[model samples]
Target: MYAIGIDIGGTTIKVGLVDGGKIINSNRKPTASTPEEAVANIVLQIDALFEKYNLTVKDIVGIGIGCPGLISSEEGVVCHISTMKWHNFPIVSLLKKTYNTNIKVSNDANVAALGEAMFGAGEKFNNSIMLTLGTGVGGGIIIDNKIYAGAFSKGAELGHMVIRIGGEPCGCGRRGCLETYASATGLTRMTKSAMEQHPESEMWKFVDGDINKVDGRTSFECAKQGDAAANSVVDDFVMYLSEGIMNLANIFRPEAFIIGGGISAQGKYLTDKLTAYCEKYCYGYKNAPKSEIITATLGNDAGIIGAAALVI
Candidate 1:
């Protein structure tokens, strides 16, 4: 079966012709200022893809879209996306007028999790949780191979769960949320703090003594070179991240936790620590089967492939 997947972003929109888990053809273009213009662009791309592939829309199974912000998948509407200034847009209905096929819409993070569960790192697991550790932590929970977005599409905001009360302020008007300590932004903050305290740390050299230049990679990269300050930052980051993971592990007990986003680029350096920490501290760790911590395989394609899985 074939499906068309569209991943909508603030700057660009990615569209793909997917055959199962693989993207057979793809196109990307800058996002328009309005939803209607974006849809028109998608129509042009879809027509070109069908013609190039010698297939019609009727030959495909469906079209699926992965969009950011609160989405009502059942209603196929985008409730709100602050970055795009969209509110209550009936996207699926708009597309349905032109194509007679199954159509689905979902949160971008949810689709990325679905993509991973269906064909990426969590493909073998019936249940999985995906944590995207980028600027902020974004996550999606999957149970029995379906997204569990929870009531009113507001659940699964895993990044907001408070790991430490009164520790740090979060953008969501909460203190000590997991996003404050476990995200790339958090890692950068920790690195900056460490750099401030340790004037002799090699991390300063990595970024040419400019604290503003420090990023998520600063500490991890410096730690590999045996820098004490950097290693300390990495250890602290892993500790907070593992604490958050175990909290989810005890509650959901999913088959696996698929770790994605920029920090996941550390690969084994990150997962090995997360697994070890969870195994040592998670509830019933010794008495029950454990969830594996693995890196995401799809990378940027996860959103697109996951949207396809919504219909495939």
Candidate 2:
């Protein structure tokens, strides 16, 4: 049976027809400005998909949605979504009423984790954690082959975990969150700081002195060219990332820790360094089979595939 998967983001809404862990057809549209408009857009997309595939409601098993913010998957309610100004939105019930079908919904990060665990990098392992290091650090945990959203579906906010007592202030109004140091934005900030410190560094040349142009790759690229300042920045970034991973390892001890997002493009270079640091810092690393650190395989389709898995 086929399932429809919808991923709601700040800028876009992605929808797909998924079967057996694969997205058969997909479409994307700009996010609506209001909750009502968003729901209407989703219904329109679902109808379009149905018509395009020549299927009826009975042909689909269910509709699954991955949304941002605090979500109650069981209740199908979006408690709060800062990016979209959605609060206590009854997404599942609304969708169910419109389509008259089974509907499932959960936090976007958690859904992405489920997608990875069921069909991507974590497929081989029963327990795993996925960290998406994009504009911010988004995390998902899987235990015994199932998503583990805490009692209120608010658990697994890994990025908010305080790594330092009085460190950089996070967007979440917290101090020293892991996201402050390990995310793509955080990496750019670090690169900018390094460039400012070493005015003669090659990183400035890479970004042409425009601090805004500096991305997660600026420091790594400059370091590849033997820029000492960039190298130090990378070293510091890896150190903070490894510390966070080690903490997760000691707590969850999952079989694998999967890294997603743009920086993951660094591939083995990133994973190798992270693995080494995790091995050194994780508690009792020598006494047990260490959790492998790897890059996510699903890429952009993770959310769609994962949302579909909620019904499968």
Candidate 3:
């Protein structure tokens, strides 16, 4: 079967075509500020692609879209998009008019998780969680091969799990959320805080004492050098990160844990650290069975791949 997958991110919208779980064509475009315009722009792109391939909408099985907002996948509408300034936008309805194909719309993170479950790390387990530690720690929980969206289409907002009460302010206007201390942004926060406490530490030298200048890579680099400040930052971060994992482990007890997103490029640093801390701190678990916290193998293609799986 052939399908098109679209991921609407804050800055870019990634679109792709998939044939039998493989990406046949893909491209990235700037996200339109208005839902009306975005939908129209997407239609043009889709039509262009079909025209290029000498195919029509009838040739495809479905079109799946993932976006950042409160989406009623069952209703095929986006209820609210805080960043997009959109309310009650019927994205599926708009697309259906053009494609006349099976259309699936859902939260972008959930779609990503779905994709991972179908084709990436989560593929090995019917029940698993995909943790994406990017600018924010986005996540998706897959159980029985379906996304566990909450009643309000707000389920699995795992990034907002309050790992630390009043710890750090989050974009969600909440304090001490898991994303506050576990995401790439959180990593920068940790590095800055560490450098402040140990101005003489190598971390300060690395960033030239410019706290705001620190980033995820700097934290990883300092950690590798065994800098006290960097180690302290990791230690503090692991407290919240492992706690979040422990919470998930205790809840679903999934077969494996898949960590993805940009920060995941740190590889062994994140895996080894997260594993050690999560195992050591988990409650009611004597031995940490192999949960297989593997890095995602599919990378950015999961969105397209998973979107296609909607028809599968």
Candidate 4:
């Protein structure tokens, strides 16, 4: 049966009709000020899809929602969402009251991981982990083809894992969290710092001598061109990221490690390096099964598709 997926973001809500791991139709609507208004808008969007596709209420199996913030997936409650200023919101009950069908909810990151695991990069793997390397690092864990959000629906926060004690400060009020060094923002910081130390580095040419212009690509691109300082930055980034991956690998021993977000666009070069590093340093690397590192394929649609998979 068809399933409806809704991805709630700070500025917009993405709704989609999905079947057999494919998005049949989708729409985006401006976020509403209140949860009630948001649910009404979602229903309208779903109605539009139904009308366009000649589907009926009986045609849909369920609706799944992915929202940002601390979500209690088991309870179908959004415990807190800073972007929407929602707290202890009974999202599942609200949706279920309107539709006599399954209504599932989970943290957006975990939902995206589910989407990737079911239909994207982790399709063939029963166990997988997804790491999103954006402004800040985000992560999700999938075990046995299911999202593992932990007992309180607040687990799988891989980015906050401490790799270094008393190192870089993180927004989570922790020092040396993996995100402080492994995110795209972290990479840019590393690049800018390297350029400052090596005024003659070719990385400056890529960013036009403007440190503000430096991004995750600045170091990797320059390093590919044989820039010494850029190479140092890239190496450092790879090392830090690898450390995080290795830590997760040791704990979960997933069959695949899927990398997503902007930096993942680096593709094979980044995955290859990570795979090599993890294989060499991961505990019991030679004795235990190895997890393959790969890039996520779903892109922006991951959220919608993943959310749908919750009820699929």
Task: Between candidates 3 and 4, name the one with more favorable TM-score.
Answer: 4
Model 2 spans > 4 angstroms off: none
Expressed as tens digits, the lDDT of each residue in 212-236 for candidate 4 is 8888899999889999998888888
Would you estimate the TM-scores of all the predictions? Answer: 0.98, 0.97, 0.94, 0.97
lDDT tens digits by residue: candidate 2, 65-164: 9998989987889999887789999988888888877899999999999999999999999999999999999999999988998987888999999999
- Name the better of 1 and 4 by lDDT: 1
Candidate 3 RMSD to the correct structure: 1.8
Clashes of each: 0, 0, 1, 0
Residue 268 deviation, candidate 1, in Å?
0.7
Worst lDDT window (10 residues) for model 4?
Answer: 94-103
Candidate 4: pairs in clash: none
The digit string of per-residue lDDT tens for model 3 on 1-312 reads 788988788788878888877898987778888888888888888887888899988898889988787888888889988877889989888888777888998887888888888888777789888888888898988889888887867789999999878788888898989998889888887787777777778887787767777888786788789887787887777677778988888898877778888888877778888888766767655565656576777788877787777766
Report the candidate with higher TM-score, 1 versus 4: 1
Report, for every candidate in turn, its global Cα lDDT versus the true structure: 0.94, 0.92, 0.82, 0.92
lDDT preference between candidates 3 and 4, better one: 4
